[model samples]
Target: MSGHSLENLASFVRDLDSACSALMIEGKNLFAGSHEGVLRCWDSATGDLRWSVEVAGPISGFAVDNNRVYTTASDSLHAIDMSSGELLWSRELEGGSDYVKASNGFVWATSSVYELEVADFIEATIWRFNENGDELERWIITERPWYFDLHKDGGALLGLGRPRCGYLKIQPGEKPSHHQLQTESPVTSGCRSSEDCFLLGHADGTISSIGSDILSDSDSNSLVTDIASLDLELISGHDDGSIRMNGTQHQILGSIDSVTLLDKDGWASSWNGSDTQITILGDTTNTISHNARIRQMHSSDERLVIGDELGRLFFLEAEIVKRRRSEIGELDDDENKNSEIRARLRMLRNR
Candidate 1:
């Protein structure tokens, strides 16, 4: 159990075909879907197959809660039991679905394809469901709304359009309202506000914070990719192969947080797009981490599990470190090692 080593937990059925589109984990097992139309479940810690099912389309999105595993294909959605892999309920949707988040007793999602094909019309929708697979409500807004934030408070939904453009707020039954907080550049990628505020990364390397009032303009051109807010600081992963800590109180850099590089097995080189996922613990200023390439990830207060594209999973115990020196000179013996770590981090962020 080295600090940075990945362990092979399990592999999916062969029909999954060496390409994992999305992955999810339940209590003690791992579930994955491939570019092919196979959904396979394996022991979370041992990589042993529990069950496999062939669906109508490629696996697009997945979520797990207790004994029930939920997923979305091109034209359909499914809920299956974890133990026996029995199909419990199946529903249908219009197009392809991309991401799904299960929390606060709901499954929230966005579309895999939101590009406009019709002359002047494109539809991106969010569907809500109950535990028993009943469709609760749905909303259609914008031409292509991808990433979303379903706030813990009620049913508040936050949607992002193409970058440099602004974002929207979707209340239960009200018309979607725009924030109009124009960006310095097109926002290439973004994540939900792990805290009360939100983070957006622009195409030109600008990272900004949006508060509740929607008029606050606090941003920096730091070339950041993914971010997580913790305590009173923002932990950001950058395209420059570095992770920095910025002060939320006065809006400035606190220090050059932690630096990490790609591992030896080409895990960092495999990242394809701006889809890396980062989550931070709200209580600690140093516990920020992420995973790329659609692997399963989970974080509690004490531990984290990162599953990779190669079907290897890494379990890490949390470590909180402080800035031991001033940020001024060239690499020392220890800083030289840290530089390599930062290089790997940048490659992941840029990809």
Candidate 2:
């Protein structure tokens, strides 16, 4: 421990084959889902599994408010009670919906692949639903929706489409508007809000702001896999243990405060982009595998919730630990000699 403490909240884990599509932090409870089509919730303090709700098809999207949780799978949407895990209602549409975002008193979603008896056709539709799970209005678009971020105060919506395909801005009741601030390269991860606009981390290791700042670069491939913003600072974690922070103006500010290891070569952090620099509170790196990548981290500027590709979820605080001596060069004489020879051979392999 680095003389720092984590928020010590509990976390829920869902084992998925590819990646997690939906995560909602409802009060102290965390709701998450996977392609397995199950909604898993856990206590945020002890990592205890509280409840699991099974659904049809794969859970493609989720959004939550004070009293209800809404999720979409295949061609249908479901409404569930947050307290008792009760099914409130479900709506099956002509097509399956994939991405969802919540704002104000309404829930918005986009659907492609309208199901037909003879053949399925791709149709992009955006639906707005009231708080009571009632459809209010619908709009059609030419492009499929990759993801949606809500901007309540700004009265605008940002939608991510196929990689480098750019984004569409939808007003309260208007047709979708296209923006050219996107690349053909895939976006690894992104986060959007009404307050801070939208941020995207690309497959080429570059990070760009979509709404206001149009700055983009191909060489700054920081290999960013996840991104989060708080108090005008952006924090992103890479494939390596490296994390970077940038200001709202899109300038690199600092780095990860620390890195902690989990059991399976994974690491977690609770830093929420509070300070000018990133902070890491606890580490299990010495005991876990180094090949593990922190897939998704959810936190405010104060606490952190992290998950890795291995489906391990942990809650950590934002604090820094002192660097420890690496064990790579600490072998005995005979073993060290053999390791040196192998190391040289490995270097030659890269050439």
Model 1: per-residue Cα lDDT over 75-161, one tens digit each: 677888878999988777656765565664566565534446654325667777776778887776654543456555545445354
Model 1 CA lDDT for position 40: 79
lDDT of 2 by residue, 255-275 (tens): 332332222122333222333
lDDT of each: 0.50, 0.55
* Alpha-carbon RMSD of each model: 10.1, 11.6
lDDT of 1: 0.50
Highest TM-score model number? 2
How displaced is residue 162 in candidate 1, in Å?
3.0
lDDT for 341 in candidate 2 is 73
State the displacement of the C-alpha of residue 307, model 1, in Å, after optimal TM-score superposition.
4.8
User: Which portions of model 2 show Cα errors greater than 4 Å?
Assistant: 1-21, 46-50, 93-96, 114-123, 154-156, 162-164, 182-188, 193-196, 202-206, 214-225, 236-296, 308-312, 319-351
